[model samples]
Target chain A: MKNKRIYQVAEFMARVLTNGSKNLVTRETGKVMREALEGRIQSEPQGTVVVLDFSNVGIIDFSCAEEVIAKMMARLIQREYGDKYILLTSLTPNQEENIHAALQTKRLLALSLKGAKKPKYLGVLNPYLMDTLQLILERKSITARELADLTQVEINTASTKLLNLHKARLVLRERMSLAEGGGRQYVYKSLLEI
Target chain B: MKAPLSLHEGSFEYLLSQWGQRLSYPSDIVKINLRDTKFIDPFGMVGLIQFGRYLRLNGRNPFLLLPNSLDVLRYLDRMDFFKYVQNLFYLEPQDFTIEEKYLRRHHSDVLLEITSIENTDDVHIIVEKVRERAENILNIHLHYGPMEIDSFVVALSEICQNIPEHSKDMGFVGIQKYFYGKKLKKNVVKIAVMDLGIGIKESLSPKYASYASHWSDLTAIHLALFKGCSRYDDPGRGQGLTNVRKWVQKWNGKMVIRSGTAYTGLIPTWEFAPYKRSSLTFFPGTLVSLILPEKSL
Candidate 1:
């Protein structure tokens, strides 16, 4: 474990509405968000779970959402952020949609505070595959045979499901050598809590 | 009506294909002749609406020439093109009124009624409503992805926001969606944003004040449209139109920007140049017309 940190998004924006309906709208608003969090993002050690909080943010349009969340995630992708994790907390459905589409466009992934259910995987994912992803997240490691026995599905069905998740880049796959066997067994795990 | 303003697009043809040619025609009390216009696409409608708006701004009264075709008439009505024209020209819904069939989505095209954008929040609301209107036809009706919708939102907001920020006055923004081809496969989306305040030429003139005597509308606009050019004195300020230009290229969209006496267009290539001469009739404002076409799903 490196370090867990939290950052507020609205703090960086010029809060105009004294009421609860504050948001960012300008074309440059997203650049501001990314710039404000730059120092912290660079200083955070590897495997750090940096929570970008949007609790008070009432609304965020798609452009700003892309510049702030999608662009940020792309920059901090596991290969780029050096195993660092960026999780969004307190995201509204509308915000999630913008962020999801943005991330999906760039083929990036991030977790949310709600563990696995709240649009953690970009925009939307198949309901049928939710449990499989959750099982992988919780167990920290999984195999097709294990998922087949646990979910009461055929081996082929489990393998197909796992392969789909792998294709989405939501899970990491590794082939382990069997000491007394000629074949290797592939293991899968969640990118979450990395 | 003896003369209906013909849209002159597709099957129906007429007035002027080249915009410069239309300058030679009479401009007093502009009335559309749509009788021969068998089909009018979104681009055609936007062209007609923008022409009427320019004429009206220049003290010309405009009216609609309703086509005898009921479907075409209802389409004109639903597009809300009637709202901007003279109320006396409003045609009654006679035999053309068909019972609402099939979950019809694209209703009357919307006009934002000369909005006075005061702040970024106001900018957001106007663009939000515009996006909703576009979605009614673009996504919910035709199913374009969120990426396209989001781009429209950002581009429209940036342009409209300029009215309040740089122009310091009110501006108008409007959009309409229709099909282009005879088979109704080519989805066309048109958006127009105009402001009656100081034009870009006058605003950016100070940047080129050194050549005060030699300064022309063409030179001023070119400076502003340049990648890093800005009207403001600040160095970090000039990506508004740059971003818009990039979006147009990405979507293969076409845009024509008219400010002061000179106008320029942006396309995928730079093979063509904008009209370098001043117009015989001066438009004291800036008008931008954008056309975006989507593949038939």
Candidate 2:
């Protein structure tokens, strides 16, 4: 049985929280954590705890996590807010590592969503799809169809994934003419130098 | 003018801090007295945005206090801060009108005021002549170091190329280098290049039109200096103005650019600001003035 109380420190803040029925938290729960920190900053004018009940969430996108948490944290710090604590009920080792890496690159001060439970140092892993997409962008102009063909995925799935990458500003899209007819086709290029 | 705000951070951080500090005031306020201000950076713009947002958050009231310069405010506006700070009254400097009139009256001594040059090939002739005149008056090797010469060539080429490429046949290049003798520290070299062609108005309009006015000359010049901005339709390497800005700052130089009625001043040490309008009229072109240090390499 998992202990009800888990306290841990990731980057800067110290997080403490009680486990709930769900194993992972919802997106709304994450937003509430951010709001809770802001409220704490307003009320206590000192340390704040951002609580995340991840008892319900099954998977989380690392980029989405950074956009919601790390970016907001940086903005709060810019406003002169002090250290913040994040408490999560559950986070997979891979998810934790990915979140930590993104936070470090953004130069944000963040604590693990998990509290005191020693986070297992799951071996370092590579996000191969992200890496592959970045590499293809550098050498040649790639389209969603081309990427799908290379990855052996459906065109719609590849297109949707590419759109998500574009939203993160990791790739740029340009309109080009397709051969069959004079219609505009979107070409994707990676912003990263892979 | 208000008391100066201080912060110990890079240009970006300092700007954010100033904005936060400014927002610590009430809304429905028209004028802010920035009296004791000393330093400014690209980030200094955040303060202006905060002030604007404060007004909006309160109501539709405008802030009417005069800033140190219209040029500075204009630059901020071009950087997209104007959208945040909707209402700003760029206070004209006290002596602005007088100075403009004075320069206009003495315009005869201003040897070259070529407003619209129709040819790109002629740019080389104009550059050589101006170089000769500056060297003759200062008695200093105007083209001493390789970097200096290279920068000069690049600056002139960039501006000249814009004439034929963007301005079509409606732009101008003006040159005026004044010498006060070699003995005095105040002896100066001034080169003003003016282009009346399309202006920055037509150039940057395609990208930022939704947020900016087509006639905002200040915004045009600001975008020109912004990193990776180009008026060209293609994804160009847009290094022209960025390089110009870097070179001028490296040498602790001064540059002023005026488009339409809006103008911005760039002093070596301090942040740039807007200057009040003068009666002096040169064709509707961009005017750039560079005052290189006497011993600058």
Candidate 3:
């Protein structure tokens, strides 16, 4: 099971900014806000899905997007915070463009949701991996055997794809015991579903 | 020194040519006389302030003879130019005042007054202040939509942040909307951000010095504006100016960055300026001018 938490970026920006501005610009202010966010993420329990809500926030420039979103994704994949996931919510199209550019620069990927719309990928990912991610998101959770049977692929190829997604920190992997047999298998779950 | 009668970003070069010759004599007091000046834009105002600051740093006592044109004086006062020029330049008439007729009236077209970009907080404030007025000036005057307004503020913030981020010096920024009836029959907004510190060449030299063919201010600026080069090796760096240039082009606007001895950037076809020019008069630091015209269609 994963615990979900919403981090209001507008609130974070207001707390960090001396002036009452919701717009995030410049690397200096970006560093300050990201450090504070990292501190908050550190205190959360393992398997926590931190949703960065950009609902009230204003414009986010490329510099700040790189400093905050790209750097955070980079560190997340490095396991700097240890077994945590991040998702974005309520991003404006302009914000999405800048954040996507920042993520593409570092070849990082993130999942975002807009209201009732389906989850969307915000950064660069191989088409194969993207299709697998889409499958996992649709199923909410799936074991390697389940994925192999659903996609009609070899279990090893399915397992490798799941492992790659897990390595990217895009999905949470859980150890599950097979019901019919005594062997253990890994189950990959989407962060959004949790 | 007698300043140009019609002072603006373009005419500022004439002032620089005169000042460049007088740089050898640091002890001389240069009186920048704007007595006959009729029109002045945000670039000219902020540029004068930065120029004054630069001269003082070089051990020169500079004096500014106030413009005799009441219209120009009123515009300067409306832009709060006196607030910054007080200590930077010795005023000829210390007690000069604006007449009641010249006082600021209701409904200001001034999108943003002359403001300083000293730190991160200042950039935020500048962004917020401009955002507040963007709906009025940017939307109504420039015909910019919500996204365009957002881009305008973001571009402004990114450019202004360059002072604290790379220039290693405090700078001034001013923005205003004007009616351009001569060349373009629509309104336009002019933005100027300038500083007197280590310029683009010096800033990028540490990392990109050896990788260029005849490294110069023009080369450094092209690397920055066109190629998105930054001093840091981080892949995510240096996209600020490149993105700004893209937005400027999309809107059919003009953007120019003038630094040490060279200047370059996007110049729309409507404006008959060189795409790139080098071997000009040497000026410390960077001077950026962006003119976004009202939507043609």
Model 2 alpha-carbon drift over 4 Å, by segment: A1-194, B1-116, B128-143, B174-176, B179-186, B211-215, B269-283
Of models 1 and 2, which has the larger lDDT?
A: 1
The most accurate candidate by TM-score is: 3
lDDT order of candidates, top first: 3, 1, 2
CA lDDT of each candidate? 0.61, 0.45, 0.90
- Model 2 iRMS (Å) reads 25.4
Cα lDDT tens digits, model 1, A1-194, are 44568877776554423322255555455666676776667777755667788877745655566667766766664345565556788876656755665565455666666545533666446777778888888887899999999989999999999987765545667678867967888888765545
Instruction: Tell me the spans in candidate 1 whose CA falls farther than 4 Å from its real position.
Output: A1-15, A18-23, A27-194, B1-73, B86-122, B131-136, B140-143, B182-185, B211-214, B268-280, B295-297
- Cα displacement (angstroms), candidate 2, residue B53, comes to 42
- Better candidate number, 1 or 3, judged by lDDT: 3
Judge candidate 3 at residue A52 and give its lDDT: 97
- What would the TM-score be for candidate 3 when compared with the true structure? 0.95
**Which candidate ranks first by DockQ, i.e. highest?**
3
DockQ comparisons of all candidates to the true complex: 0.08, 0.01, 0.76
- How accurate locally is residue B295 in candidate 2, as Cα lDDT from 0 to 100? 55
- Report the poorest 10 consecutive residues by lDDT, candidate 1 chain A: A12-21
Q: Write the per-residue lDDT of candidate 3 for residues B42-68, one digit (tens) a residue.
A: 999998998899888877888999998
